[model samples]
Target: MDEKEVPSLAEIHIAASHLRSMSLPITPILTSSILNTLTGRNIYLKCENFQRTGSFKSRGALNAVLNAMKIDPNLKGFVTHSSGNHGQALSYAASIVKRPCVVVVPRGTPKNKTDAIEHYGAELVICEPTPASRTSTCLQISQERDFLIIPPFDHPDVIAGQGTIAVELLEQVPDLDAILVPVSGGGLISGIALYAKRINPNIRIFACTPEGKMLEECLNKQERLWPEPPQFLNTKCEACRLQQCGSLTFPIMCSLVEKQVFTVSDKTMIDATRFAFERLKLVVELAAGLSLGAIISQSDRLDSNIRNIALILCGGNIDLNEKLPWQQ
Candidate 1:
């Protein structure tokens, strides 16, 4: 499959079938009491944090890894670059199929995540914590070893795997006016908008980012990609903070996502993370907070008529023993 093109609906359905065979059933979408009260709109949380490997990333990793080995039995192991959650996910998935996996992560990744990757028995290579460095390291290793690369985002099978969330969301809720998804490389949102828009065009999809997304550049259809940040923001959203969005993700986002991509502050994200812990009794990761944070900070700008909203709590790979950011 061409890496640049957006995945078709049929491709997503095929990936869903592969996933179901592995016993990866649909995750639950629960109504959050505190969040609903806070937003004045019925807020449903798609709790992917409870998913296998503690993140939605498992869906894509398993799909891509399993499908590859299934096609070519003699294929070598997998390689990938991740900030945190995806590394753990790929490592866990590779362990399932008894394949050696190598993950290149940025330096200073949360110990909890790196520990999980090691626990899954993958070799971890820590590099300079930048998008370029991570990609370069991973690509170099993959090319040198002739191993299949399981991307965190920005691939056909991977995108389709993530799309399964939207398929389940519609089935669970039936009717949702708007959905706020945390966007890092745009994989999740692209996969989501692909299905949500296909099923019901009326459902609005918003990409929530912790950094200050330039509205003009983001909305420019010709650009079809996130502008490279001059300097990465110091945010606890470890899964995000990339220099720019993925090429495959950008095109889909440009076509399907709502024009106004919501940007929230790091403080708002931290507060949202704390809110989920204290109020909802859910241990959500910092990157997942972008969805909830956008709502809290931009409540006035949201559609007044929106009755039902969905938020994807994407991961919970936090170090339980580590002090919460608010405590410091």
Candidate 2:
């Protein structure tokens, strides 16, 4: 998509309004006394885990689905590839409109998430655990079945849909000094940064990632570079296992988001997840825990002027039956 086509603040507002009309919950901005005390700053959590489909992916999926239906009412169905959350969200969104949906999920995806995708009425197709495999399978299915592809990220409408979170976040906490977002394919942060910076130029936007150099390297080189294969698939942060950033999302991040990306280890994310559950009484996936981990372990790196920070807990889809990260 054209750089000029990046979703504007007005577009994000429209997405927020559309989501409200769809009866999507405006997830609350929660604050924890314990977290604030630990961080020495007012910390707010934008709990997208409470969102429909148990993640913010629902906002983008539904927006894209509704927009596609509006433009082509006769569309056969929808198709997309996801590690888990986006597939469930897309399936849920498609079911609301009584449309057939197909989800191309990567192999080794948690069974709980795949079960939820099927429960939401999407036909699940498993592929190799690689970005290339996911994209190829999705494309093949889309072509063969004449399905509309609502990508998990990298699309303008989807990015705009994710941007709706920023609209809600800024409205709820207008004076936030910084916003910490977990980055995967970059859709969520791209949307948030695009709108948040326009609203408050001084508000810092931080991208928290698994302890990998893809995002950091990309930012440093000022270009997208897919280094050697990432070990994301082997990590506990399955929701953010994308090997590289999205084409559309990277440029947006390069321009609007903080230059320095925060990288967190799997252990740190697991510890953060445990902390959230034990103290904050919140269930967060490892990916969501990345932001919390950064705030907990890397607060000193933040600018001195930053005080109030908002962390986007992007999802809460973990298999409790499985050995929890801390247990292992």
Candidate 3:
């Protein structure tokens, strides 16, 4: 769906109001010295690490589920395949509404990811870490059990819900020049770009994917009659390394966004991770640190006059003990 066709400003205001009524915590933190020092720009870290279920996925999940609940009071079940955070978000949402959940997780997904889902009382189904298998497994289960598919980053409601982040950011930093967001399936970035651009067409929305991932190519392919699957490039940022971008997100990003796609080495993610722990005094996972890494990698590209910037800290659900490849 053309994000433009999805909702009007007046309609979006009502949607945003409905989301706010859920009482989910929205955090917009202004703390990032390294980013400031590197780019000579005032940076605000939208610290969504403190969000419910410890990630921004909660925003999209709740929006999808509650909206689904409104349509179908007896929502049969909930289902999704995620690397980590999104699964936990869906499971937590399911628990709140007392619905059964079946999560299809990649085989190598961290133990903590599975644990969180189970803790929320959702059944876990593990599959190979590939886009084909993830989709296939989720479809199979959804067919058998009649579960509502809550895609990680690929639905209109989910993207608009995630856009609420940009809504809060624009309110928090009215003069914000740029916003950096991590790109796994493009839900968060799509949402942010849609609303931010609708408000101020000049705001640049950067897509920060794992190093070497062909996100720029993926975004372009989104315009075709039969768009190809996202070309998966393997990297140590497992949480953010998707085989492809989401179908719904890809098209919206290609049409609406003007920002270029950039990448940071696993090393930058590691350093940024440590930086968040040491300097920001927060426990952020590799996915959360990608925004910092993107700013660091593209520090030279940004105009020095661009003083106000925003980075979306997406999640913090990694197993702290497991040595990420960058750490070693």
Candidate 4:
């Protein structure tokens, strides 16, 4: 679909209504005392980590599959590439509808996420850890089979499905002044911004990204960080390390996100991971900490006038048993 055809808040509500008919509803938000203490504001956390399949990806995945099946009842399967969470989510969603799913994953995906993918019965196809390799393999598979592509991000249905978060959060917290969301392919933030703006045009949106890519600069230049993803895009956090934002999502972000973009280092994420665990009592993955890290580290950078904010705790699929470099 053309970027001009980006889904709106109305499409998101339609998606949410359909999802509920399938008995999939909403995820809840919770208070973050530690974050409030650190940021000195009433920061509410929209915990997608607690979402079914352990991430917000499930919403998009499910919506994509159901919509695909509605269009083509004879659809054999769905395909996509992911470092982890999206793969598992697609697999789980496909399982519920009793359709086959094939996920193209890079060689170094976290075991926790990979295990969840297989556990949901998706066929796992391993490729070299790069966008080219993953897409090539996925395309090759799609051509060989009749499987449709339910991309990790960038699709209208997927974006609309993700927007459901804003639908819930807006209702859950009536007076939220801002929302900080982690950005990779930019689907989550795009969806949320679409809904948030339509519901309350005054709500400020911000993007939080991993440091090295300089995503804000790339977005400004209309360029991507890594055409072929770098190796460091490995374990410390896989979710937000992608080279570029989605074509559909980037435009929405440039228009809607009012707050200055914030970036965080791996160390910041790891320390925040530890903080979330020790203080907040939430075992968040490193990437999940980017939202919290943005609020904690960039307190001065944010507009001082804004009072209440919400942070999207994107996911919690980290390998708890795997020895982190910090442990070593």
Please, what is the TM-score per model?
0.92, 0.95, 0.90, 0.92
**Residue by residue across 203-288, what tens digits does model 3's lDDT show?**
88888878666677656665433235656556767668665666677777787765467677877887888877878888788887
Computed on alpha carbons, the lDDT of every model, listed in order, comes to 0.82, 0.88, 0.79, 0.82
Query: Candidate 4, residue 151: CA error in Å?
Result: 0.9
Please give the clash total of every predicted structure, in order: 0, 0, 0, 0
Clashes of 4: 0
TM-score of 1: 0.92
Q: lDDT of candidate 3?
A: 0.79
lDDT of 4: 0.82
Give the number of the best model, judged by TM-score.
2
Residue 131, candidate 2: Cα error in Å is 3.8
Best by lDDT: 2
lDDT of 3 at 17: 72
Order the candidates by lDDT, highest first — what do you get? 2, 1, 4, 3
lDDT of 2 by residue, 52-130 (tens): 9889999999989988888899999999987588899999999988899999987887788789999989999999977
Error of 1 at 262 (Å): 1.6
In angstroms, give how far residue 245 of model 3 lies from its true place: 1.8
Candidate with the larger TM-score of 2 and 3: 2
For 77-153, candidate 1 gives per-residue lDDT tens digits of: 89998757788889988887898999998788777778888888899988897768987999998999887898888
Runs with alpha carbons beyond 4 Å of true place in candidate 4: 1-4, 108-110, 218-235, 324-326
